[model samples]
Target: MIGVDGQAMNRFQQKIELRDGEALFQVGGSVRDRLLGRTPADVDGVLLTPDPEGAGGRLTQAGLAPVVGRNGGRAWRGRGIDLTVWPREPGQPVEEALRHEALQRDFTLNALYSRWGIEEVIDPLGGQADLRRGIVRATGAGALVRDPVRVLRLARLASGLDFQVDPATLAWARAVDPGLAAGERVGREVLAWLTQSAAPGKGLDLWADSGAIRAIPEVAALQGVAQRADYHPEGDVWIHTGQVLDRAAQLGQGLERGALGVLMLSALFHDVGKAITTRWELGRWRAHGHEAVSRDLTQSRLKGWGLGNRVVGWTVRLVADHGRPMALARDGASLTGWWRLLDGHPCPELLFLLAQADSQGRVAAGEGEPSPPLFTAGMPFRAALDRWGQIPMLSGGHLLAAGVRPGPAVGRGLTLLRRAAFLGRWREGEPIAPLLRQAGLLAGRAKG
Candidate 1:
C-alpha cells in the first residue's frame, strides 16, 4: 500500500461509518485524481465487510439509501459522494478481498485504492508506477474482453489525463469488438469524450487508431472521402475531422456542459454529408448540398445514440446552418440575412463556433495560417451581430400600413424596407408611405 496526502477527506468521517471488522477504501478515479495532485470531484469507495446488511444499515443511518449494483454490492448516494461498496464473503481477510477486487478492475491505474482518513493506496498490479509514468495499462488480458466497454473508458482516461495507453493494453483494446458494448454505455463515453475531456480530439484519434470507431459507423465512413487539394490539403475527410474537433475543444472552453457537447457534436458531423455527395465534377471536387445531407444524417445518428430531443435539435440546426455564414459573407449578403437564418434557433452563437471550427480546420500543407475567405469571411459578422443586438425587422404589416395593398407587392415592399434598414437608409418606425409610393409600390399614385 502507498500513501498520498490529500485534502478531500476532512469530512470523510462525518459522512459515513462502518461497523467492527469492516474496512472501506476510496477507489477508482477518486484515488487516481488525488495521486496526481488534482482534486477529485467526488468520493467513491468499496467496503470490504462480510456483514452486508450491517454495513448497508450503517450507511442508511447516515442518510444514504442503498441500491443493489450489478456486482451484488450496495450503491448509495447522499450529500457528500456516490459510493459503490462491495461486501466480502464470509471469513475473507481484508488484504485478500482488496486484491481480488483490484484484479477485477479494467486498468492498472484504476485498480489502485486508498483507505479513507490517511489515504494509503493498495497497488497489486504496478498501477502506481503506471500512473506516475502517465500510462494506461489494463489490469489483465481478459479485462477488456470481459467488458468491451472498457475501450471507451480507456479512451476517456487517456484523453482526460493526457496519458498514453500502454502498447500491450492498446492492442487488447483493438482486438475486442466494440459492438459488444451496450448502447447507453457507448453514448455516455461519447458524451465524456467531447464534454468532459480537455483533449477531446485525442480521444477520437484513439478510437480510430484502436479500431473502436467502427462502433460508430457514421463517423468511420469519413475515412476515405476526398476534398479539393488546394482547399483541404489535410489528406482526407477523417483527418479534417480530427483538426476540427481539436479546434472545437479550444473554442468550447468554459462553455456550459450541454452547449459544449452540442458544439463538439456539430463540429464532428458538420461535414458528414461530404462522404456521400463528393464528386469530381467541374474539374475540382465539390460536395453540393452536403450541409442538408449532413444535417439529416447527424439527426439520425444522434437520435440513434438516444440523445435528448433538445440536443438533437440544437446540433442539427448548427449543422444545417454551419456552412451558410461563409456562403452569405462570400456573396456580400447583409447581416440581416444571417439574422433571418437563426431567428428562431436555440443557440445562435454555436452556429458561429461550428462554422469557425470547420473553416479553420481545412488548411493546406505548408500554409502558415488558414484564412480562406471562401469560408472565414463570415466570422466577423458574428461579432457584428452581437454588437447590433437584435434588430427589428420591417414586417408585412408595416408595408400594409403604407399605401401598398395586400398582394405579392406587400412582401416585395417589406424586403426593400428591410434592405434599406440594414443599409442605414431606413429605420424602424419611420414613415414608409412616401417611400413605398416613391419606389412604385403604389404605381406612383399618391397616398390617400
Candidate 2:
C-alpha cells in the first residue's frame, strides 16, 4: 500500500482527530486519488456534526474555519485546487454515497470512488477492475435507466480511457429511454466526451454500437459505407472516421476544452455525408459533393443536439471549408485559388491540420495517395502556395463602405484585388478605392 505523503497525512489526520465529536464529511475525489498516489487538485471536507450555533461559530470552535460555507462549498486555492463541502452524509456506505453522487453524474468512471480513510477503491460495482481491464461498465440495471445522460459519459470514457464496453452494458446504454436527459445535459456530456477522450474513435464506435448513433442518424450512416478502393482501402467510411477520431483524441491533453470540443465534433461530422454521396463508377467509389453535404448535415446535427451557437458556428465553418485546404495542396491550384480559399477565413492552419490527419488516415488504408489539393510535386506550385499568406487585399464590405456599388462588381472587385495582390500588381497597404475607381466602379454607387 502506498502511504500518504509527508505532512499532508499528518495534517489531515490531526484535523480529523481534533473534530472528533463532529462527523467529518469530504465531498471530492482527493481521497481516492491520494490513495492511488495521484495528486488531486481538490480537497473539500465538511463537518458532518450539525452546528446548532451556526456555520462560522462551529468552524471557529474546531479551529478550522470561521466561515467555510461562504462560497457555497466552492473555493479554489493555489496549485489548481478546488474544494467543495457537502452539508450531510448523502448515503449509508461509500457505495450508496457514490449512487447519491451518481444521481448527478453522467458516467460510470466519474462515479467510482473510495472511502475517505480506506486504502482500497470503493468501486462497489467493479469500476476499478474495469479501469484496469480497459473496459467501461455501467453501475447497475438502473445505471443508464436512471439517467440517460450517462450514455454520453460512456462515449467520453471509452475515448478518454481507451476502453471497450461490456456487451451487456452496451446493450443497456443502447436501450436508454429518450427524453429522460435534458438538452443541456446531453449537450454538455457529449461535448465533454468529445473534448476529453483519448480514443475518440473508440467512443464513436461505442456510440454506433449502442444505437446512440441513430439518435443522430446522419452521423450514424457514415459507418460501413464503401469508399473508392483506389483512394480509400481503409475498409469504409467508418474505418476512416475511426482513424481520425483516434488522432483527434490524442490531442486532448492541455487543449482548450471548448475549442477542442468543437474540433472533435467537426472531425466526427466532417466525413458524415460521404455515405449519402457514395457512388460506384468503374469499380471505384466516388463521393461527389460530399463536403457540401457533410457541412449541411453537420450543422443540422449540431443544431439538433442543442449545441451552443458559437460551437455550431465554428463547426459549420470547419465542415464547410474542411476540403478547401486540399485545394491549396492540389495540382493546378494557382495563387488565385489559394487566395480565394483563405479570404475571410480565420482558421486556415487548423483546417490544414485536419486535412492532413484525414489524408494520413486515408493513406494508411492503402488509398494510394491523397487526392489533388494536397501538394505532390511542382516547384512553381510550391512557391505559389508558400506565398499564399503574404498576399492580402480589401474585402467586399470595404468596397461597399467606400460607396462602390453593391452588385457583381463587389464580387468582381474583391476577386480582382485578391488576384492583383497575389500577382504583385496590388502592393500591400495600397488603397483599393483607386483600384476600384480604375475599374470604373464609382464610390457608393450600386451598379445595375
Q: Would you estimate the TM-scores of all the predictions? A: 0.81, 0.69
Assess the local accuracy of residue 180 in candidate 1 as a C-alpha lDDT between 0 and 100.
82
> What digit string (tens of lDDT, one per residue) describes model 1 on residues 417-440?
655655567677777776677778
Query: Which tens-of-lDDT digit does each residue in 1-448 have in candidate 2?
Result: 1133435534554543534234433333454345435665555443333332344433434344433433344232322223223333433453454455444433455445543444444444554566567777776767777767667667665766566887888888888854466666666767766665566676677677776655556777877799876666567888888777666555445657677776778788888889889998777788889989999988876787788798898888888887765555655666667677766666655555566557655644334644423323234433655566666645778778777778988888887777787777888766677777778876554431
Candidate 2 yields a Cα-based lDDT of: 0.61
The global C-alpha lDDT for each of the candidates, from Candidate 1 onward, is: 0.77, 0.61
* TM-score, candidate number 2: 0.69
